[model samples]
Target: MPANNLRRIHSLDGLKLVMVLCIVWWHCMPRVVFGYSLPDLGARCCEVFFLVSGFLEGYRHGLNYKFTFEELWLKAKSKLKRIYPEHAFFLVLSILVGVTSGKEWAVLSDSNVISAICNALLIQAWIPSFAMQFNGLSWFLSSLFFCYLLTPLVAYIALKAKRPVGVWHLLVATMACRVLLEAECAKHPDIYSMVNIHENPLVRLLEYSFAYYLALVYRGRLGADTCSKKVSFLWSVVECVAIGFALYCVVEFNGAWPRWMYTLVFSGVVVIVAGERGILSSLLGCKPMRYLSVYQMQIYISHAVFYSLGWALFPTSSVMAHVSLFVLIVIYCFAVNCLKRIRQNKPKPTVTESFYF
Candidate 1:
């Protein structure tokens, strides 16, 4: 499908907002919340992010058959430009926090200087130990940047596939590889750390690649401009079932299932949501939900700083304290976004002003 002909998937924005909140909740709340395991929930949420990102990338670039290495460089640069500013801002903030608090676990220590450098370069996830250093959540940015760098290759592969079945084959192959790796890790246990498996760029690239193929499959067979009432109702049923299965795995399985299973379940939800043919998709794609989704990235990056500081200052186990801290973080994210808009809208000097004596 031509890019111009494709409608914007507003439902994705709402889904991203939901996932971001789940991550924040995992970070702030206790392990088990109202009977669900936050860790499992957070893990799947992270994968959802990767899948969503990959889908968007493929949706935009996969059909560009002429994509070249130069264009690939430009794409990588564009992604870096989008993400680096907030990443740097948070990194500096974390350093200042460490220095000001004079805490024993300060990220500014001599032992961590290299880790800080890796974080600065957005290569922290490539190094297992450095992945969680400084702003730990920024490891997502690092792995995502790696995936963005490989976009051209992924898009090229997607374009080469002659049929939807080819895309399915690619998706299954990638999942198989990931499952094999997981099994290897499980057998050795010492060969690869859990952090490595979780934050490794190679592992994440596979997940991202699977999503890319999944996007192609969506474009080929699922995405449609219109649907009959019966079809929409059936889609709604599928969406609900997908959500229920995903949540059940997150809750009942409690991380027992292979990671790829969760990815497949999440992909099902994503494909349906992207269709926007279902009642749930309609609700998700509403104006208010789309608006809230704009600040998801800012919230994800900055929440940890506020969370850590709140704990340090209050040292409380109160549920209300956690709620208050989360509320403060949201407000801070809104303010930051407003300031960014103002800066972007500020006028620049005219060309005539460049003249000098």
Candidate 2:
């Protein structure tokens, strides 16, 4: 399979929309989606995001495994270009929104000022105390940036592996390490809480690494054979089953399932979704889902800002306010996208010199 085809997987876009919407609802909704309120759907949605991000990064690198310092620098630069501008814009906007609401201390307090610096440098998520401040959702961005920092090394390992199964073995080892760490943390609950373990970028990097290796395996599998109708149908069946299992976990476990199980279930769902040939894929690939997918990041990051506004305006009108805020965010993102397009389309100045002069 060509990289371009992998990139064009419409099912992935639909999946992205699902993840984004789930996160938004989890944050903005008054009540929980599933029967049990223990494990937020939003948390699972983040796992999907992390895995998908790692997979896409690996896919983009294609078969190239060797990385020079220059290549790593380029990769870092590219990721920064994609994320930083919008992130900075929203960071400032969030602060401004707070200040305008007579909450200057939220942005200007000593702790928050320190948090803003950490968030800007993408290190806020690494510290336990600093993890969820500022834009509470922004820790994901910082953690993702950490993954990007390790992309070159991950690519190098994937490229140099003896076989695809080696990548699988690596995933096993990584998970084992994670479990061992959890056990150690369990012994000293006061010192090593879940917040201490889960919130760190270094720990999340282990999860990201698993996803990176999985992408290598997936790409190899994807290229090895063209799925016949029967195989495709079977995979679709698997996809449906995966989704059902996830829902079951949500209800049965009440979000109390082990972390590793959560990772495994969502990773399975992601694989099925990325297969991109199922009936479920066709529905997710629809125009509205795909359109919303284009602004998925915008929706994810900017929703918090408007969330505050929504609650303030409709303190008594929960459902109506939340929905209206969502619509407004979508419109805001659409307008921003349009403006960016127009800016890019504008002609650049040309410089010329007269030979006689």
Candidate closest to the true structure, highest TM-score: 1
Over 117-186, each residue of candidate 2 has an lDDT whose tens digit, in order, gives: 8878878887777777656777888888888888888777756777767777887987787677766776
What local distance difference test score does each model get? 0.76, 0.71
RMSD of each: 6.1, 7.0
lDDT of 1 by residue, 1-357 (tens): 777676777787788889988888788767776884455666889889888888876765566656777787777787777789889988987777666666443644676887888899998998887788667899999998899888778777766776767777888888999888878887887876644777888888998898888887776676645332323788888888888887877778766887877878888788778878788888877777777676778788878876766666666656655766778777876676666557668443222110100
- Candidate with top lDDT is 1
TM-score of each: 0.88, 0.86
In model 2, which runs have C-alpha deviations exceeding 4 angstroms?
1-7, 32-38, 63-65, 100-107, 193-198, 223-232, 313-320, 346-357
